[model samples]
Target chain A: MQIPKPYLLFLGDVRDALAVKMARGILTWRPEACVGQLRLDDQTPSLGIDDLPLEAGRERGAQTLVVGTANAGGKLPEHWVDTLEQAIELGYNVASGMHQRLAAIPRLADAAKRQGVKLFDIRHDAPALEVGNGKRRSGRRVLSVGLDCAVGKMFSALALEAELKSRGEKADFRATGQSGILIQGEGIAVDAVVADFISGAAEYISPANDADHWDLVEGQGSLFHPSYAGVSLGLLHGAQPDFLVMCHELGRPHVRHLPHIQLPSYAACVERNLANARTTNPDVVLAGFSINTSNVDEAQARAHLAEIEAEFGVPATDPVRFGVGPLIDHLIERTR
Target chain B: MQIPKPYLLFLGDVRDALAVKMARGILTWRPEACVGQLRLDDQTPSLGIDDLPLEAGRERGAQTLVVGTANAGGKLPEHWVDTLEQAIELGYNVASGMHQRLAAIPRLADAAKRQGVKLFDIRHDAPALEVGNGKRRSGRRVLSVGLDCAVGKMFSALALEAELKSRGEKADFRATGQSGILIQGEGIAVDAVVADFISGAAEYISPANDADHWDLVEGQGSLFHPSYAGVSLGLLHGAQPDFLVMCHELGRPHVRHLPHIQLPSYAACVERNLANARTTNPDVVLAGFSINTSNVDEAQARAHLAEIEAEFGVPATDPVRFGVGPLIDHLIERTR
Candidate 1:
């Protein structure tokens, strides 16, 4: 898939919890491709790509403004229409992670049409797929299994894929959700897929062309996550991964959205994921861990990583903070 | 919902599997609502409402000819369009159970429109639902938990609901499939729903209004069926039923569509279903069994029912042949 350089736009108050999903995804996964973030919420200090203004981003030749949030219901907030209108009118393409298509909205669509820019609604228009038959896939597969939903499964997979590409290895990152769809031009939002077709979508994305190549399938949800366990199972069954890279947020006590439910220990999470994976593919194995150290400092993150490594007897690293080098290297030496 | 009497039209060969699904469902659940079957296949003798010809059904004041077969993929077959056109020309409303809406087909739609008769696409407009939280339901619920797919879970639920109504009890049969949708006036095709929303759709359909009333919720695939276990889990979690009526097809040794996978024992099926159900509702109980004895003779069917009842210590009956009286009585006595 051809990658597009995009200006990141967080139209809402940047400090708000809903605003950061797409922004963080782009900032973490494809930082180099991101020209800059438009600081709609002026109160907060601009970090990373937010240092450059929209005008500067335009001058730097950013083609699209990747709307920076996979908000609840995927609905564009009414207040942000003006910012979207401005972005479209300025000859910039608009890419949205919302379930509601950006092209469906009148003002933004009209502006984009007049300005000759494309509106990419990443979540919509996913082709309907049939039920997956667990046939033996013909490629080296490494799935980034998560400790919880939004714990950097996509980031870990993409980082590993990037590393593989840098090393002149044939690799592909299969996106599973909206953020991943935005980053990688192709993917089915597995959670959005109907119950009967989850595994099918997974199978569709994680196809094996050559035994020597790798398909780093980005996982969604977690086996321990009560609400999302089905999606987790479907993806796991679909991928039928030979090796698993456990992705986890450093200090997440419980599953997000379900605060009452406590997060399982690293060992328990890995065991559950592996057990589920082994149901469809008996020879499945956990390669390593991709720890999300975004919430912790360098020393704290490193100490926690070491602690998990000692506890689970597996190599762990933050793909962003450090890199998924240990996990990638392990996968190469083992599977490839 | 108002029941409409229509001439049952199965344009295909009578022995065709799809022909019998709607015919059997209607005959078993709402026989009074069925006028007669139009025997397109000449060799086979028509039973029940099939004895009356289309002219006879029309003379008897049948307003609509319910297209009694729910064919897979919901597409109206090319040959069947002629019969549908004839039905429309004869000043009759058309009801189809197919996933492909009857209104979408140009010829049939135009014919119905021009004839000033309504075309009911039963499975077309199921509302989108949220994720099921498995909250404690208020009213009595008796879900027909099947041993496998196409084992007459819907049939048993409808039969029990009819029995309850005959006994002057306020009970509703909630349909989960296309055949059930045609048999009843409404239902969501739960299988078509996204994995995350299956439970939610179940919760939506099985509403708790009065404590005295009962919801005879139709089950989908089996917990033991490998391909459909996720849906089974979601439905079980969604219903949070007070009681379960196990549905099984006698003489079936393996799961449908998956021939290599052997069917689990009765005890294992019940245990797994109850365990999954109890995750959402702790006090849930197995009320009875709805055994589909369609493959066997009367004596053999009776013997098998008796054997299952004696073995499992639960009432067992074929809803179509023996009626669901024993199971209905058991549920009424226990839950009420």
Candidate 2:
């Protein structure tokens, strides 16, 4: 779904930095789309942008009010309904990344309807999709698969897009999750879709483009992750990536949420992903490694990267700490 | 969702045998549960059961009227509404395996509500599920995985369940699809569940039981099928089978519905399924091959089964044409 922008990011009394991750991502990557930040109180965390009132933000050309901060239960706080209704009354479309739907609240829904404004529920909003056809689409795709959840798959994909664009190559960052969708203003939350349509939604996310164009598809859960591997596999097949970049977090002891399950080795992760990806794109190949080296110091991170590159014979780098230049270079060289 | 037995199977003017597959499945596997049949017209294929009216079937102890036929688009035919309402008015819970919701039809929904009967859309009914925790639970489990869609995974699972029970072993067939759900009377259609809950629903389907008990979990979609691999993977992780049976149909040249995509080799399918299945149950092993030999002569089917058994060093049989005794023997021996 294409969320209207420029957006006034709503951080409703959220004190934790993690709660405002969606807002932070949008500001960091698409700062130009973010008109201003709107907070419920002074205690709320700042996105380092102007804390403009709804009227002020709308006057500044904010077309949408984005509820980017998540609450404890991912629900829209009852107290925040007044502010959302007022924003809708001001002729601004409202968007949310919360688990709950904004349209489900009668006050906000009625206000939006009266003002002819739209409510975009990023997690719940998706176009009707067909099952994955496994047809070979004409475009180069690079997907970031991980060894587990929250391994910087989205960050790596954004980096890949930025790097490709800097080199004057055609590239687009295709988001598959809530935060990424808010950042890019368009994407399907494949995880929230009905199970059978996972791959179909992924295919819709990155459709056929110019052969030289690259769609950097952000990945989700890992193949080794018992809870979410199905989503990962469906996305992998639908994307039909020409190149894959394995994303891993340094020093992860176990699979996320499940303490008893240990992470698979990098070799196992890469081999399995490639084997599954080959179902749609037979010529698919591993391009590089995108490591999350936040747990290690610069020297250790650099050394680890060097070791991985030497062992796997592919470029390795922390996309957040360093850059995705090496990965992009490898992708370009491999394609050539 | 527990569909109350005994069911009066509804075949709505469907002349094609394929359309009545669900009715046939229920009749074949759970004949005791099938009280009678109700057809709108004489042209509809019969299940060789008593053809009774709604009131007559209810009087005969049928608690549910199961719409077990599929129309061209899986929609409930507008003309079939009167029959469904009549069943509801006669105190029969209406259960449908159609893509459309039974509760969506106002006349049927109102009738069921007024009659205090339930409308169960088999493909849409699911309990709220948590994400699969990937924890080891008690009870031995066997899953039927396949090389492609409709390759007899459910039939193999049912056969395995039947064979195990015939040996006086404790076993239950866990259904994961529409037809399987109708036959078994309870299950979550994993494919129709929200993507995030596929595995969670699966775990719920076959919960912890006695250590000697076997939950013969029916599988869906092939890991190599582009449209459905995600559902397959999620189900695999959720089922956490200690042993797996590979289901394949002979003479199938390509993946179902996607003729352009060739099927993966038997070795590849087995290796991939085992590798993925190991994410949840690390000790998972291939117990046997369940081949659909309807396309071949008895001699050819027997010869192919023998060749497969010798190659894989696992029991192989056509569960339908031949018995699943060899497969069950292998399972029993391996577990011991």
Candidate 3:
């Protein structure tokens, strides 16, 4: 049997903790497929633009579990026409942040297809773990961390939490940090800034405590939105987790504009997040990044969901944590 | 005749407007000497234990300006350690904004001799031009855009205004932009930020139809102080100007640990006040920076004045704008 290739990826600054967990997970899945992440700071004078071909060069068949990919088709400056062209020549798949509102999709897609890159939409591929499996959550408790409007994380966290709880097991949901600085332009650096996430978690569950299974949520608004990014790192670094459950924006958002919660595009977020965790040795990691919703009450939102599912295989119903349930039960069975 | 090498040179984050003016002035005056400016962004990521050595490699062999070099040296991790060693090995003189502080003198002398990089003290430099240079108040009036406590700009503007007024010439000084928001994290788009600096002279003399130059007198407390490096680039950028001036700090109370302002160094004053003809981009430019007052009284002030004259080879005297005399008459002659 041919060994399946794993991909590595991450988002934003590599220093982010969740990204670190995801990278470690990729390495765990296929140590040989390990690939790191890359990010360029705005302060650096333009590294004079890359001349590399995007898709073709990316598909060089390194068996990459790339932590993430580059955002080749981003807000390219007019003078960087050469750089944009180089991105097309590399044969890397293009994944936009938002589907409908994305102005660069057509151009990027044309470039990707022309180069024969396998562009997968994460939304459509995310069927909940129980969608086909008869067995429900075997027995496990999940610990989740989320920030922002807490809508996407809330839904995702609840689904996993409920699945486990229905099995007569315990699962906990924790929301911390509001990404208030993104819209409000105010900053406060303290544990209390996230409404005492550590303290509250300490009260609910001790770090030294163990369960049949344990999962920690990473990634969301706090990872990238500047003021909150550092706080998120601090939280995760202190937790010293058993496993990392990384949630990503796979396909696109259900809304036209992502507001403050724009997901990373294509290899950009993945590569960076992956690089962040290359050093941290986590045991098991399951990751997902996509948006899907069912029975949409909002028309535009519903349309966005459909578009994302078609484009990135990531919709609300699709579980980003592909084999997460099975993996959780496996751990639970062993621990119990 | 062989051109003489500059006994001193300035290193600084010339990307910062005021710092650039001061650092660049040293080069402009002695263009024959190899003068290289380095930009040490405060936000560069650290590698290993040290930062990536973003500016480490840029250290040149010539007189090192090392403006705000303190930002680089510290207990950085190992990666940064190697980078710093590389810089020192490459023979780049390192210095910091603290050169005007008493503690920096020894470092300055040592770095100068060892690295062949005369770390020039910005505050010690003087505005190259006298207050009055008897040319019609060229182009638009001079509105020295600066931070609120731009005590340097304030003093420069007052001195320039007095010169222009005494010489029967006309000009104005204005403060622009009520606040500095561009410096805020992710609040304003980078491209549109430059629009903030379109007016300053008019803000002073023509702030309102009824406003006079005296009306433009704003206390330093009113200016924005995000990091309080003592110089506010947002203010300079916002008040896009006819001519810009700043007060560079020199060691003494004339300033010892001066108040923090725009850039948050001991040089809370503009290291140099530069006057450019923005209209046609005239080749002739006027530049100025301040000296700290060591004066305990008339005798001491005069004694210090003689010392400055001997050091810089320029006719040194207490500011006539802050006084009244033949010096004031010369200023009027220069500006009018």
Candidate 4:
């Protein structure tokens, strides 16, 4: 398979004209852009790009696109590859949806390039990175949280409390479901957030760090959600936190599916995270190093500091195991 | 610190008498059960224990319970382990709020064994392995999927399509999301599908056989959600699948945040899976895998798989890289 240099693509039920229109905007901007997230009935819904103006592309030659509709016609289309390719050649700038995964884009592109087939995969139109400006938070501090109501939320908030107190400053710890952490400019409407950002509200703070205290937030699920959309990234961009301390579950076999999809998976998460980071640009990303008990013979928590340090690029100490001091120390060092 | 055998517990909103009653039932049945899901706020909002009368056992020589309460007065009246050693002394029985991970449960247990702590922590609970079958799926042979939408709902449907065809049977593929996948005989809820059977729906006709034959069943979202309040585990014990196929995001690292509240850290995925497995008792477990392509790397994916395999002993593969055929073959071989 010819690997295509990766580009972002957003996946949705393109049969929805609004979704298709949104995708069209991306395609128009980049001749090779691909639209995705089409399910089986997409074609029946009258969203076919058969008549879309692809002629604008001999200039760019229909950016190698992959046209996937969420479903295979009663059977994998006999000329599925050919018909789709021809459509794009004839100026249909949409590829069939391949779920939300753009991981195969690079590979598909490489193959298409070798075969001299212009490929347009949906990975090319993923939402751009998130960056926002709002009430900022920052500091070097230790936080020990009680995992009660909202697990990640409490941890983030409590950690923020400790960090802010250590710095002898205060900043609001807001969990905006996507619109954003907080906006410094005039209040923007949800419509604008989605229309303008093509995502949720921004979760950001002022990059300048004007706030006297650091706000550490956790658990309130954000970032990965599409509706909350670009808001999380936007907020982070604005905050430019010294270190992004994210606490979520990494799938571990031994953990008994402990961290199921209550949230983001590793790939989309990283993609969105990096996308957000490219805009927000935090100094570091520290995943709260937690594991499910049954998943693996967890590295002996006591003897596992070196591994933690090596893997995370920072010292590792369990607060529950080691007194809260060393754990906090490492957390601070990580942000710096 | 005393380490103990951990059991997986799913305690949904303890404030709901139903939830508390489930906890009480677990205590009575398991007796050695510890570590429940912190369903509600331990403070004013929740009764904390749902009138189950936790105090009845206080006479068991100050029964050691390492309880982590949100409103848990930092200074407890008695019988709770805020300190690690105190937890060790509470051998055989312990309770704590949700999302509190044991960074060193096994190791501590081992150490305590040496120090004579004789501890017991139901942090990692396994379903009863024996599969008891009294009923079979009647109706349309709808496969109820319990996999999270996180991996995109393609797994069960995709696998269903592949498995049916491989067995030389033309199966109708229907991924019912908003609407529930229908079936008859023993009513298989999400709980049974996850903990008991290999596949949620009893039998699936491959969708690939005929596109016109497809019926994409929408998920009711919350309806499939296991009601931990009811002693649902017993219900699942009725239907045992031949082989259980579980989908996982192999290298999807972004989900690591949910574990903060001792809520299973995405590992809850597995616990929930097994919760259903306990009832269904599917023999072989086939795990379909994928990753978040946005931010993670191949190394993380490899590690995630290796780690999960080591822990669950289930066969997992990424459908994107390795087609579903090989995974099916592996499952067939394991079952044979």
Candidate 5:
């Protein structure tokens, strides 16, 4: 299904990392699906988007107004409700990727319902999942694992799936989180599953199929992320991938939010991911790397990519900028 | 709270491994609490318990008839309901640790309600758990790691806690599965928790408090089981244990049910558990081993225990038979 071009709204300061993360994910991966951005604070010189006032974006044919900033608690700020209400009143779908449910908020939900518009509270509506049976099927499985959560794992998996499909390859994008679920129209929200069955849910979606097919299973959480390591491990084991793509942002020094704790080296991170994956599937192989260069300049991004490729001996690319052509080629040849 | 003395029912072949397992666990850990066993078959010559007919156990003052055999799919067999109905009609509490809820069965539930007795569907009524924050609590954590599921991880943890308590030491039993939850009266059934929050549930129940106190956290699943590796890893991380106790049945050559999957040596299993545990808590150590010698003769059990102790250079004991005094003493002295 072709989702309408969204009017991405970042009400918080544009330079704030958490505030701009979701917006960056959209702009980088699905920029064509976005009409423009509406921000209250305008200090986002590096956002690299058509910045519009909310009314102007609607006038420009934005069908959905997406609240694109995430707070620490993922709650929708009270002040943003007026802007969301305005969008709903004008017959626009309201979408949010926060933990707080827009449908749970009486005012916003009521407004959307009254105006006959859809309310997309991405996290809250994820489907319940069953326990995994660990049955391996025919097709090759490729999973995007990241150094930390929200470091372009989903973007990379989706981008790689799109790249593969463009070349007439039979590939499926299996989402493990809400955003991927919204995009794919079908996928178990792995994180929403009861902890006992998270891996099972992952296994359920990406089942054993023919070798000609490829399942680009979206990754959730992270092996190193303090808050979500269990989900990361569950996804790793459940996916039981033949190929693993290491997704990384250019220069994240520490896990986001936990400032004092530093992230392990890139090599160490990849090694750790592979080792954990081996606990269940000893044959899991690292295919390549998908680097997120959203915050880096072109030259710097290229240099870092080259450095990572040389160090890890894997094809590395910024899926949004450089495209995942080399990585896709490598996967096709290796799996075949 | 003192639980009602249960009439353990092994309606399936009494010689079946799973049928005798629950009976063995209850008899070993809390023998005084069991009135007697009610088996449909009489071929269990090795089951060291007073075998009673269903009516006889109830007549001997049994308050509950516990359906003790766990089937492959955890579904209640159709044939057993008739006997259960008879027990319910006689006003005995019904308890089951199966995935199929005894309270959900129409006839049995109605009969139990009418008869004014409780139906304890142990796994179904496990408390809902919150996501784990992975916060290390004050007390030193001691977790039971197993070579396979049903290898007495829960029994060993409970036994150790009892031994410590009898010695006037402060120790808490933290249950992570249905059987333990049924006995403890209060515990988060970790396996029932949403996948993303399994570890968090472990953390929520075993908070950091006094350094001198100990939380003997019962483990679930197995690190080597293909279908349950995720849960095992989550528990390892969630427990964030300072100490680990390896639990293994004496004669199992491979993972139960899945043949050809050879069980790893005690050292290899302990090392693997420690390596996974070190992902979060770097200082986790294996304190000792809890060998399940129920299937072995007394001479064979003692010989195996001596061999393991010599090979690993650690204290080893069958917590049920010889008690966990040696392991507890070692843990107390080492931690002190």
Candidate 6:
């Protein structure tokens, strides 16, 4: 799904910063694409971007009003319908990452229809996709696989894409989740797709490109994560990556939300991912490690990275704390 | 997803026997649940069952009219709508394994509603399920793992369940696909569920039961299949089988649809399935090998089974030809 931009991010009375993390991510990565922020009330968290009303944002060339903040139960609040309807009437396409679809609300749907605008439900709908054919596509892909959920896979991919662009190399960050879609302005939320089409959607996300071009495919749940490993495996096969960057959090005690399920060792995680990946791309190689070191001191993080690099004989770094330069360097060198 | 019992199989002018393989499966496995067969034309293949009109079938205690034949594109043939509506008017619940939903047809929907009957589109609908918690539950599960799609995973599971029942052991065949669902009269088609709920559906299919009871969970897809490994992996984690039976079709050269992609070795398939399965059930073990030997002579089939048993040190048999007795023997011994 291609979300229209420059976006006016809608933060509907959400007090928690985490609820508007998608807004923050879009502002941080693609600030130029965001025209302004729209809030329901003064209590809402500010994304540090300029605040603009619906008409003003539209006048400023905002093409879409993005519902960027998540609420309790991921539903669109009934009270916020008027603003969404007003935005639709103003000739702006409405987009949402909520569990509820904007089109499902009659007011917003009718308004968008009358105004000849669109409602992009990135989390709930995807373009029709065929099952993955396993044909070798002509592009170099680097995927970030993790030891568990929420372990910097998206961050690592975005960093790698930015680094590749900075070096004047051809690369694009392919998003496979809601927040990533907002940041990239286009993607399929593979997790929200029908189970039969996960891999097919992944294939659509990153299609055949020039042989030298790189598609940094963001991964999802880990192979060992019982709740979502299916999505992860399907994405892995569909990507058919030429290189893999293992993502992990240094101090994660267990798989997310399942305390009884312990995280696998880094070695085990890497080995298992590679083994499954080989079925689609036999030449796939581990390029580097992207460790989330936010919980550790700089010195300790550096020491851990050094130990990992020494043991695995690949570059390792925290993409957020340091940068993805070393990982990109390894990727470029190996691809060359 | 409990389909009402004593069905009248509907053969909608389908000339090919393969198109009605689901009907054949139900007849073979659960003959008691099938009252009669309904054919639109005399040219349609006979299922060796009593042929009856809709009214007569209903009088014979048929609770449901099962559209058991598949068409070219899996759509509900437009010409067959009148008969389906008539079936509904006769107060018979309708069930179909077609890509098109029975409820989506307005005539059938209205008729069913008016007559107080139900429309069951088994292939397109699933009950809501929570994400898999990866917790240990009561009762043992034995899942069939395969090297590729259509390697008889469902048949092996059904045979095992039947064999266990014959010995006066507590067992139930838990279906995961369309044909299996028809035979068992209840199941969630895991592949058709939303991607996030694949494992959840599997967990729902086989719930907690007596400690001595066995839920023979039918499997789908293959770990090495590019199009379907995600479903396989998710089902594996959700089923969390205490014992897995490796299903392989002897002499098969490649994956079912993708000829370029070769099937993995028996050792690789077993190892990968066991490794992934261990994340959910740490104590999971390989019970035996359920090899399909239809392509070979009896002597060759037995010889191949003997060779496999020697190599893997597990019982191996053609569940169709030699029966699942050896595999059940191994499972019983291991569990005891």
On the 0 to 100 scale, the lDDT of residue B247 in model 2 is 95
Docking class of 3: incorrect
Candidate 6 lDDT, B1-336, residue by residue in tens: 789999999998989889888899999999999998999999899999999999999999999999988788888877788899989898899999998888989889999889999898999878879998889889999999999999999999999999999999999999999999988889999999989888899889889999999999999999999999999999999999999999989888889889989899999999999999999999999999999999999999989999999999999999889999999989999889
C-alpha lDDT values of all predictions: 0.76, 0.92, 0.31, 0.33, 0.76, 0.92
Look at candidate 6 and tell me the lDDT of residue A93. Answer: 93
Superposed Cα deviation of residue A54, candidate 1 (Å): 7.8
Q: Considering lDDT, which of the candidate structures 1 and 2 is the better prediction for this target? A: 2
- Report the lDDT tens digits of candidate 2 across residue range A104-123: 98888888889998999988
Pick by DockQ: which candidate is best? Answer: 2
What TM-score goes with each of the models? 0.79, 0.99, 0.24, 0.25, 0.74, 0.99
lDDT by residue (tens digit), candidate 3, A229-284 = 32333333333333334343333352122343343343443333332222122332
Ranking by lDDT: 2, 6, 5, 1, 4, 3
- Model 5 captures what fraction of native contacts? 0.44
2 versus 5: better lDDT goes to? 2
Residue lDDT tens for model 1, A1-336: 233565555545546645575676667667777777776667643545555555677888887777776556668778777777887777777777777888889888788779887887766546768786666778888898887888878878898899999989999999988778777767888887777877788888888679888998998877655466667777887888988999888777767776655677788778767765764577899889888788889999999989888987778898877877787777778764
Ranked by TM-score, the better of candidates 2 and 4 is 2
Model 5 TM-score relative to the real fold: 0.74
Q: Clashing residue pairs in candidate 1, if any?
A: A194-B194, A194-B195, A195-B194, A195-B195, B6-B64, B7-B65, B74-B99, B74-B100
User: Tens digit of lDDT per residue, candidate 6, span A262-327?
Assistant: 999989999999999998899998999999998989999999999999999999999989999998
lDDT of 4 by residue, B1-336 (tens): 222323323232223444344234334323443433333234323323332223322333333433323232223222222334434443434433222333245554554575554442222221223222223333222222233334533344444555656687544444221111111001122222222221222222111223222222212111012112111122222223334344534343332232211112334444444443433333413343333322456676557666666766654555555445654565445534
lDDT of 6 at A285: 89
User: By DockQ, is 2 or 5 better?
Assistant: 2
